[model samples]
Target: MLFHFMSPLALSNSYFLAFRPREEKSQPRLSTPRFSSQRTLFLTENNQKKLPFFQARHHWMEDYKYLFKVVLVGNAGVGKTCLVRKFTQGIFPPGQSATIGVDFMIKTVKVGNDKIKLQIWDTAGQERFRSITQSYYRSAHAIVLVYDVSCQPSFDCLPEWLGEIESYANRRVLKILVGNKVDKGDEREVPERIGRDFSDVNHFDYFLETSALDATNVDQLFEQVATRLTNDMKITDERVHQYRADATNSSSNQGGPIKLIDRAQTQLNSCCSRQ
Candidate 1:
């Protein structure tokens, strides 16, 4: 599995909470909820009102640095839905059923100091939805191919998934290999080494073994996706800026002599006409 060898970076940012759980009992019960056009007002014991953390910066909530579309594709019953729910909503759904067509969700996470909005597309694994799911790959910035560690058939189907991704997704798209259900240790079918080897041979960007049921590496999985994509985009933006700067500089440098020549030519014409 690929391990992040860089120095630790600030990856997660928690929202400011209005009240701490421990302080809730000591404070007087909130009463007569008041509202303002710009803030949410809640009255205190002395009749003074205060704004909640979120209410203070409600407009800033919509601001983000970038938006990336991440699509999850894997065989049926590989806990793809569970992974998305756990990462976005912090829930491991019980008795989860196979997806029908495709489910879409939006989540904003902080990477370093920039806010990134991820448009997660959880595609169904059934054959009927193959056409629909394939349509999503072309636009995806990242594609996470998941498999069940306890199911050999799911692990075996990875090559087929890779083929589809290569045919439909962007060539530079971030490809991640995930072995789900590591919590199923006793019933494990695919070895970790084998999965890692597959990921390496197939030139996947990253690989990890995650257990969505237990919330193992769930946050890390998505965090890596956000961080990697953000870094790539920043690099691209820098290159574009540099290219524009270079072009502008070249045009300005070339214009100096050309303008001088034009002015000299105009002066010569005036002199000749005067003579």
Candidate 2:
């Protein structure tokens, strides 16, 4: 099934060659590699970095050490898809169509030495898709609530979104309030101070303004998501480790059946002496 789906793109050149007639001199074929062109550095024991040319292969499969689910919920036209596209593909999708139900994308980023994969779910903001989108809230590690800076109604409807999040999401889920399209300076409706106040009063974990069009703080936004979640997960893991260690120490210190027998014998001896 997987091969069937991938065969078209894999055999496209062969299909084109079969249709063309044989010629005396065939033009040189130009092939473009699918992977990134960036060079990977491999350090040696001498602390020297090895840079090899034409090293297009990536070690992403082995480097991906963590996976996190992040969901975006906001009004329909608030640029959620555009933000995800800009972050994942580095392109501003002008005139992007409204999302129907839900869309998802995966992008890997480095948080310290650990490679963190962010599974971003872009939920449709339409009223009809509320049922479908709400189902995703419970499984998300972080929920980003986005609003348009130029739309007052979008900002005003934040309470409704928050209510839905509270009802459907986990209690410990990280919540972030994002004011998007901040580049529209003249047409801005929600002031940054007001947005901050709203986020503070509502207990959002963090707040920021971003522009998917200008690529302003777009990278920072996702980086913050990955960093915050990575730190939080690390802290949680440490606490669990400490708890397990404490539990083990406690169990080892507690006397087993032998101590219970010794206590019972001591009580019998005391009764016999009193008699």
Candidate 3:
């Protein structure tokens, strides 16, 4: 039921052990305390509890919290959706349809001992969706800017896309410039040299030519983002999600819910250029 947001960009492994408050029914007076790591969710007499953040179970709702907001953007046909789809679902969404105004999805991945929740937002690449969609960029811990390796126009639009993310989205957004559609190597219009040069001079976190079609290096891109967020200053939800409202109406113009994966179905889901 997992959806790969874009084939080139990955949402990597995250491990979260939630600590919750549970009371033991069996009462026994003992000088020493008991420790069991076997229990997936646990509680202690002390004021602490643990739960797995990604798994939505009855006990976890009261314990775990959202960790990070991960956002993705690019031109309409640049494979943004494909890259995510491939990484999350392991299979791309079949066929293609423009992501309406916006799309929301979340996947929890592990970073070392702690599990970090990744809130993924995939927006419409079309220019018309810009106003309605740019709002997703704010509060994003990481912003993935994508472009098609085979298309000139999409590649040319990198700066404007980067600027939009910078000005409107999270000002401190971590960026990865993706040169997608590397499978179309023969058809490439933007040379790797140019893409590499721009990424280097701009000091982008990372850049690579990837093929969502082949599922290449998609996961690596996200791993880098996760590492940055975990190692850098850890920002909390209040400062980031203060503006995002979930209690409001479903169809409101503002950002809303995370689309949970339905077990029955799935899709195949890249991009490049930065300046």
Tell me the whole-model lDDT of each prediction, alpha carbons only: 0.70, 0.69, 0.59
* Tens-digit lDDT string for candidate 1 (1-275): 00111111111111100111122342221221111221321112112334455543442233566656788999999999899999988888899988878875667799999888776778889988898788777657789999999999999999999999999876767899999999999999999999999999999999999999999999999999989887766555444445445656777878842223454333322211111
Best by TM-score: 1
Q: Which of candidates 1 and 3 is the stronger one according to TM-score?
A: 1
Count of backbone clashes for each model?
A: 0, 0, 38
Candidates 1 and 3 compared: the better one by lDDT is 1
RMSD per model, one decimal:
17.1, 18.7, 16.6
State TM-scores per candidate: 0.72, 0.71, 0.63
User: How far off is residue 256 in model 1, in Å?
Assistant: 8.7
* Model 1 ranges with Cα > 4 A deviation: 1-62, 256-275
What's the residue-level lDDT of 216 in candidate 3?
Answer: 86
Please identify model 2 stretches exceeding 4 Å from their true place: 1-62, 255-275
- Writing each residue's lDDT as its tens digit, candidate 3 over 1-275 gives 32322222222221111121233222111111122221321222111434343332434332322245677788998998888777776777768687877655545567776565555678888887787667656546677888898999998998898788768754445778999999997898999999988788776777988878898888887777766666552332221222223323443544655442331111100000111
Worst 10 residues of 1 by lDDT: 11-20
In model 3, what lDDT does residue 235 have? 32
